[model samples]
Target: MKALTTYIISQTKLPEVSVKNTIELLNEDCTIPFISRYRKERTGNLDEVQIGDIVKFKEQFEALEKRKIAILKALEEQGVLTPELKQKIEATLDLTTLEDLYLPYKKSRKTKAETARQHGLEPLAKIIMSQNANDVESIAFKYVKGEIASVEDALEGARHIISEWINERTDIRNNIRQQLERFAMISTKVVKTKADDENAQKFRDYFDWEESLSRIPSHRLLAILRAESEGFIKTKIQIDDDKALDKIESRIIRSNNECSEQIQIAIQDAYKRLLLPSLSNEALQIAKTKADESAISVFAKNLKQLLLGSPLGEKRILAIDPGFRSGCKLVCLDAQGGLLYNETIYPHPPQNDSMGAIKKISSLTEAYKIEAIAIGNGTASRETEAIIRKIHFKNEIQVFVVSEAGASIYSASKIARDEFPNYDVTVRGSVSIGRRLQDPLAELVKIDAKSIGVGQYQHDVDQTKLKKELDVVVESCVNAVGVNINTASASLLSYVSGIGPKLAENMVSYRDENGAFTSRNDIKKVPRLGGKAFEQGAAFLRIKEAKNPLDDSAVHPERYDLVKQMAKDLGKSVQDLIGNAETLKKIDLKKYCTESVGLPTLQDIIKELEKPGLDIREQAKVFTFNQNIKKINDLHEGQLLPGIVNNITNFGCFVDVGIKESGLIHVSNLSDGFVKDVNEHVSLHQQIIVKVLEVDVPRKRIQLKLHT
Candidate 1:
């Protein structure tokens, strides 16, 4: 256990006390958000990302230790547990090196060497490897008995054993591993049958592609692997043959005698038949894992940004799921995103009922007291926006074109069906678009993160890892922006600290059975929400206008007494101290520090008191697209247009310029100089003006550059 703590400390370079305390908290079943947010003193004030690193390295260390124990047991059972070997195995830090150490002892598939050994040819193999005999055939002739009918058979069998010996040499295997890691090239060629297949066109870029395995971009590698998996291409990893062989020959051969020649032959056989294939595949897998991590990191970052997108804050919205022939599905949502009215409007070419649509929209807006209009950025979206803007509304309403990426998926989901039992999929989808404009985090949590459509190669990467990573991002985002307990949906509450789907369901059921929770203490009366859950989650759930003012703040219930004491010392009531910035700044944080509470915790309490339940997110703003450009044909080179960045990838960002096809601003065109990160220039849902660099109508692809 101490070793595990030390290993994590070394890996993360975090403070020794911090890592140890975090591990202790994790073992006590505390969550990352809880430890980082509430237990600041115990964790030395480490943030969520830093504590996440500690957890990651701790798990890795525990896994490696488990494997070490198993290997030691195996060695003891095999009666080969020498003190030196035992010490080496115990000290091994990585799985690959430990496996290499255990390779010779591990039971392997039946091979040429095992057959040679069974035939009593081991002595001959040893004699040939000695490199002392000038005429090895005479020495080999002596073993030509008992299933070895001739000298040639004996020599061949001896060479097979020597090959196995070379294969088992740890040093030689490690050397080959190094060579493969440093110099291997991954090459792919299209399968002849798939060369002309229609489905193969998407992967044409990867066909006949070759690049350094170490330098290939994560997206490109994932694409190549996906193409190979779909049987469109064949891939191989290789290094310089002569360079690798020369190193192996130099390591194994000392003299040019018959015995040396036999040793050389064995070396060749060992390398070509064993080391190259095994190590090359290992290198490929290592590269693939790295690529998966890079891709997943990109995905997780984008998801964080998308979930933290600016919210329009409690507003009645008129939303439209835009279409042409099918007509626009319209839904009016109240401030809390409850659907109040639904209708269909035909304002496009197929049914030009512009006047009727305008009158209906105006009437609905007025009836619902709508504060904003959200139009889905889909087919006929620009035309719908134009029509809406032209409406002579009686109120000042902001119009926004929301990204419709996963709206359909959310609409057809079981959660949606449950939420609106009497509504159709069209109504549900329009509601999603509207609710997203209201609160993206709450609405996005209802859909699977992968389906949100922000990641490249999201589907092709490791599904389990991607899901785990995205879930963490969602949980982090959810806790960062505390939930409104009175109005939060079960989907939104599930991500709160220590409140999973089951408990979230229970809380919602309790809330529904009763009227509403008035205080943090009231949550304790709910079924199955025990002391631990409340401790971990109470600070993140806000009840507006609660009798106890502290219930609406992020200050934990356990700290309520401590804060009350502070207020009493200052001769003021708890409510008086809340949001009293003048008084909060005057209190000395160090005077409140105790054994359990430190300066960090006191400081956080002061911040929370400064503005109780203040939202950390920015407010959403309305964006306007170029009304002249409704399709790709309207785009021209060097045309300046306003656009919103809908998707960000490692390579660049994709901007929705109010067209059917999104435009790509490759990383090179992001700035006049070098561009290290795409987010530095643009973010999801950010409105920016861009200059069109090129447009290919044949391919329906438009290239863009950032407009200063």
Candidate 2:
């Protein structure tokens, strides 16, 4: 374990104890699910994110070790093995770094070195490099009688040979590569032909931008690179090779001699012809790789926040997909997300019926005892909110504007069709818009996450890699917040660790064959859901009205016996001891210690007993706004306007006010006082209330004040 820890830390740039602690816990034969959930004490309470990092680090370390062994064996076979070389190879972390060390020994392309060796010019080139020769061109004449005809040809041939010798020097190439990477500037220019392309327009702003290779933001770099690849722009890294070569040559050759100029020329030519392209390629690739990694990390962060966005809990909600020219689509769903009502209201249309629409909404709110009204933050949303707010309902209800980011995509999806076959697309969309607010997990599974628009550059990223990463994230989130076994749809159930589509369907089939799961143990009867599967997934599958309360909580069944043992030690039945607060208080759970169970596990158990199937919801919840106030002229100084944060740049944030336009809240207007980064003040999806400070109706833009 210590050896593995050293290896992982050295190879992965991870801390030593992180790997050591992780491997030690894994050696105890705890499952990923178990270690992540119950063995928090052993793993230092490392969350799923940290555990996943450890897993990746371990895999990469092992793979690198295998590669190192292969490289060492191959080098030993070539009979160039040295203790120093072996140590350097073993110590190297990056594959590129190791490859840099081994480039001299690696197989080559057609080069002047092989040609010179064939023509017998290597000895002459060597003589010239040694600077022992009075004149290199004169010395080369001795070997140039038959093949090298003229002094010019012989010098040219010998120069090629000497240049190849210079190129083969790994130290020189490595030094030059390092220098170029540090000083190069990444410059992108928009291609002139495609300036009018719709996608090209977004990148037009970046076409003429320049940034140092080291400092460009990952998002902007990727966006620019993607635009260039799509033929909307052209990009290149500009480096002054003359300046770079001068520094390198001066550092390498300190002595002033007649042969120094020749050597310097050879070095410069070798760099320009042989080493620069490969090194620039490497540097660019590294830059791109770092950018890609940063973007993915940001994407993962945003996605986790978006996916775990507060679930409103199970509630009957009336959804309104608002439209102006067309009528508003109204959908009402039961607490379990089953659609109960579908109707349309022409509040503002050819057959405008504002009062009639109000009456219909009022009637449904009263008849269904609607708990909330979910209004889509699209067209006519604020008008619908206004109308719904005016209606007097016998039942108390709250109105929320739900983000309809992927609601349209879900409505047009095959799953949506299967769920709502008789309804029109608009009605299905309205229901999805509502259900997303009621339970984000259950409804979100129906739509592709990339379409949800929470991530930047999700579409342009490596699709397979993105899907694998996002699927893991979704699964982690779904299981972390345990699912309701009986009510969860197959789409939702498939996200469970061990339950794929077929198994999810089988579980549902088994339930249909028998009845609702009365106990967590009954899940074993479901075909393909064997003991190992149960061990991984059972803890996250909650059974409402189950025989054991612990089963509904995140407590694994293996620990059930331990809980019972605790109850026995307390001279009370397990059921009585679980809810018996007085007895539980008296019992020191640290006394029930095992190799796996500790303070964290015992405390989790006590908390679970308090609320067996607690669904933690967000507090002080806010909703999305559909209306936009585009122009500053259209708003009074004190008017409060609902706005969507469109773009967050260095200066300020741009918000889309519903007038088919947008407004900017300058950095000064962002607060009562000073602000640094716009991202610190607002995020991409945040819906904020802004006061209109200044209006430019001619430009169709508004200046907003966020302070008040």
Candidate 3:
């Protein structure tokens, strides 16, 4: 544990006390969100990202320790566990060095070296390697007895043994790795047989491409690997061969003799046949892991932003899944997102029933008392929005066009089926659209993070690593915003600090059987919810109708007595002290400090008391698309239009300009000068105006520049 603390501190460049305390909390099975929010003083007020870095390094330290144990046990079994070697292994923190020390002991199939050793050629190998024996032919002829038929055969056998020795030398191996790191080029060439195939056009840009392995971007690397996987291109990694061999020979060949010549042959053979293949693979794997981490980091950031998007709180909605020939599917939802009525309406071409659709929609709005209308931004979304705006409602109603990227996946999911067992997929999809407007975080948690469609090369990256990162992002976002116990679905509840899928399911089932919880204490009655679970999750779960107002706030139940004492000292009731800033200011936070609680925690409590359970996100607003542009063909050079920033990448952002194909706003056009990050100028779902630079109608691509 102490060693882990030291390693984490070095890796994160964090305070030693903070790293030590965080590791202890993690050792106690406390989660990232819990430690970040509840134990602010213990963790020195570290945010989720900093605590996350500690967790990452802690896991790495454990993995390294596990590998060390396995290596030690292997050495013990092989009877090569020297005290000096054990000390060396124990002192090293690097995995590469540790593995290099263990390389010679690795058991392998019968290679040429082992075959030559079995034929009694080791003495001949040593004699030639000594470089003192100038008569190498006589030295080789002395060993031409058992499998050696001639001096030439003896020389080849000795060279094979020398090659293995060269391969195992640590200095030579390290030198090759250094060269590969600095000078290797990753190149790809198109497979001549598949060049003209129609399916190969997607990877045409990668054909005959070459770039430095150390300098290529993560997305480009993933794309090239994908093209290679699809059999459209062949990839290679190489450096200057002459430089590498000269470096190796300078280290091995000391004297200019026939023995030096033999060592030269062995060095060349070791480099090409053994070192290059093995080390090149190791270098590529390192590069791939780096690329995966980069890609996964981008994906995690995008997922966090998308999940925390603005919400239109608790409005009765009428939502439509728009279409042309299939007839739009419409559903009415109450304030709590429960479906009240569902039907089909066609207001576009092939049906051309705008008047009839308007009459039905107006009557439904009056019948259901709908306050807002949510239209899915799918096929015919703009046309449907126009038709709905043409109708005048008796009451004021706002219209919203929500992105329906993963609605179909959610509609066909098992969770959807469980939620709406009596309804078909289209009705379920429409309800999802309505619910998304009410709360994007809640609706998005039900779908897989990867399917939410805000990542770069999500599928091409490591699936296990990507899923783990996205889950952490989701959990962090969920706990950061908090959840309404009565209103939150099982999926949302599952992301709360200690409440996993099973406990969330149990809580929901208990809610269905009983009634709404009235206090924080009532949560303990749920099955499988014990002390630790409550401690980790209770503050993040709100009860709006509880008798104690603090239950509705983020103030934990354990601090209720302290807070009551604070109010008592101020000669006021707890309810009166809540949100009373002047009264809250009168109390000295130092008076409440104890061994377990410090000023950081007290400051957090004071902040929570000031604005209890206040949402950290903004409210969703209505947006309108350009009336003149319907598709790519309608767009031309220098035309200004309104668009929404849909997806962000390292290079630029994609803007939806009321068309099927979104336009690309390259990073160069995002600012007047240098643009370090695309998110600094644009965010996910940001409404902005752009000027069209060019349009390729046949290819369905639009290039735009930021209007600002």
Candidate 4:
């Protein structure tokens, strides 16, 4: 445990106390968001990302320890647990090193070497390995009894065993692994049968691609792997075979003798029959894992940005899930996102009722006092927006094109069905679009993060790992922007610090039965929500109109007394001090700091007092796309057009330029200067102007350069 802590601290470069405290909290089953937000004092004010790193490194060290234990036990059971070998295993921290040390003793299916050992040719094999024997055939002849018929057969068996021995050497395996890492190239070729297939054309860029494994971009690697998985391409890791053999020979071949020549043969055999194939696959897997992590990181970042996107706040929004033949599904949502009304309108082709649709929108806006209109960016979206634009209501309504990526999926989900059981999918979807405009994080939590479509290679990455990372991101975002306990749905509440799905459902059920929570303490009445859960969650759960003003702020209940004391010392009520920035600034944070509540927490409390329940996200602004350019065909070279950065990748970012086919602003074009990270220049949902560089209509590919 101490070693683990030291390793984590070294890796994270975090204070030892904070790392230890974080590890303890994690061991106590605290969520990352909980520790990051409420336990800031214990963790030295580490944010969610730093806390998450500590958790990740701690888990990795624990996994390594578990592997160590398993390896030790296996070696002990096999009666090969020599003190020196055990010391080596115990001392090594690298998993690959430990595995290599264990490889010789691991039981496996009978191979050529195992068969040779069974033929009582162990002595001959050792003699060749020593590389000190002259006239090795004579030495091999001595072992030509029983299953070994002749000197030639004896030498063959000896070489087989020697090859296995060479394959199992720890130094040999490590050296070869290093070689593969430094010099290997990932090469891909189109499958012969799929060469002319239309489906394979998507991967034609990789048909004869070869690049150093270490230098390949994560997106390209994932694409190649996905193409290979779909049977459109064949991929392999390539290395200089002679160079690899020479490396092994230099390590194993120590002398020039009859046995040295045989040892050379075994080296080649070991590499060909075992090491090359095994290490190639291992290198590829390591590369893939790295690529997955990179891709998942990008996905997580994009998800965070999208989830924390500018919310329109509590507004009466009229949302439309636009369609042509099926008409537009429209829903009116009140300030709290409660569905007030829903209907269908056709202002588009096949069943155009433009006047009726315009009249209906105006009437609904006037009746419901709608402040905003959220139109789904789907089929007939721009047309619907144009129609709505023509409707001159009594009040100016803010119109927005909401990315309806996962609205349909959420609408059809069980949660959606439960939320609007009487309504159909279209109505539910429209409500989602409207609610998203009001609160993206709250509504997005109800849908799977991947389905939200702000990612690259989301489906191709490891699902379990992707979910874990995304869950962390969601939890961070949810806790970052505190949840409204009285109004938050189960899906949104589930992401709150310590609240899981069950606790969320219980809270919702309790809210339903007991009415809106009047105080933070009221949360404890919910079933199965114990003291610890309340402690971890209460600060992040906002109780609007609560008796205690602090209940509506980020300041925890435990610190309510301290704040009250501060107010009392000031000869004022807590409510009087709340949001009083002048009063907050007058309070000496250092004077309030204690052993557990340090300057960081006290400062945070002070900040919270100045702006009670302040949301960190910005307000959603209205963006206009180039109305003249609706399709890819309308785009011409050097044309400047407004676009939204929908997705960002390591290589570049994909921009939605008012078309079905998004344009790629490659990283090189992101800035006039050398650009390393695409995110540094652009982010998900960022509105920017891009100049069309090239367009391939057949491929539906658009090349765009950022309008600097």
lDDT for each candidate structure:
0.91, 0.75, 0.91, 0.90
Q: How do the predictions measure up, each by TM-score? A: 0.96, 0.85, 0.97, 0.97
TM match of model 2 to true structure: 0.85
What digit string (tens of lDDT, one per residue) describes model 4 on residues 1-708?
Answer: 699889998888999999999888988888887777667889888987898889889888888889999999999998989999989988887888888898989899989998998999888889888888899887787887887889989898889999998899878888888888999999998889999998888889999999999888888999999999999999989799998899889988899989999889988999999998999999998998999999999999999999999999999999999999999998999999999999998888887899999999999999999999999999888888888878888988899999999998999999999999999999999999999999999999999998988888899999999999999899889999999998999999998888889999999999999889999988999999999899889999998888899999999899999998899888899999987888877887787878878887788888898899999999999999998987889998999999999989888999998878899999888998998777889989999999999999988999999997
RMSD versus native structure for model 4: 1.6
Clashing pairs in 1: none
RMSD (Å) per prediction: 1.8, 4.2, 1.6, 1.6
| Poorly placed runs, candidate 1 (over 4 Å) | 142-150
Model 3 lDDT per residue over 1-708, tens place: 889888988889999888989988988889999898889889888998999999888888888899999999999999999999899889889899999888888888989999988889999899888888897988889889977899989999999999999899889999999999998999999999999988888789999999999999887888899888899999999999999999998887878899999889988899999999999988888898999998888788788888889999999999999999999999999999999999998788898999889999999999999999999999999899889988989999999999997899999999999999999999999999999999999999999999989978888888998999999999999988999999899999999989999999999999999988888898999999999999999999999968998998888888999999999999999998889999899999999999888998888889999999999888999899988787788999999999999998887889998888999998888989999888889989999999999998876778899998
Off-target runs (Cα >4 Å) in candidate 3 are 145-149
- Candidate 4 positional error at 187, Å: 1.4
Which of 2 and 4 is ahead in lDDT?
A: 4
lDDT of 2 by residue, 339-418 (tens): 89899899886777999998999889878878888888787766777778788888778787777888989988888888
Show pairs that collide, candidate 2.
628-657, 628-658, 629-658, 632-695, 633-695
Candidate 1 lDDT by residue in tens digits, 29-120: 88899999989988889999999899888888988989989988999999998999989998988899899888888977998999999998
Off by over 4 Å in 4: 145-150
* Ten contiguous residues minimizing lDDT sum, candidate 4: 31-40
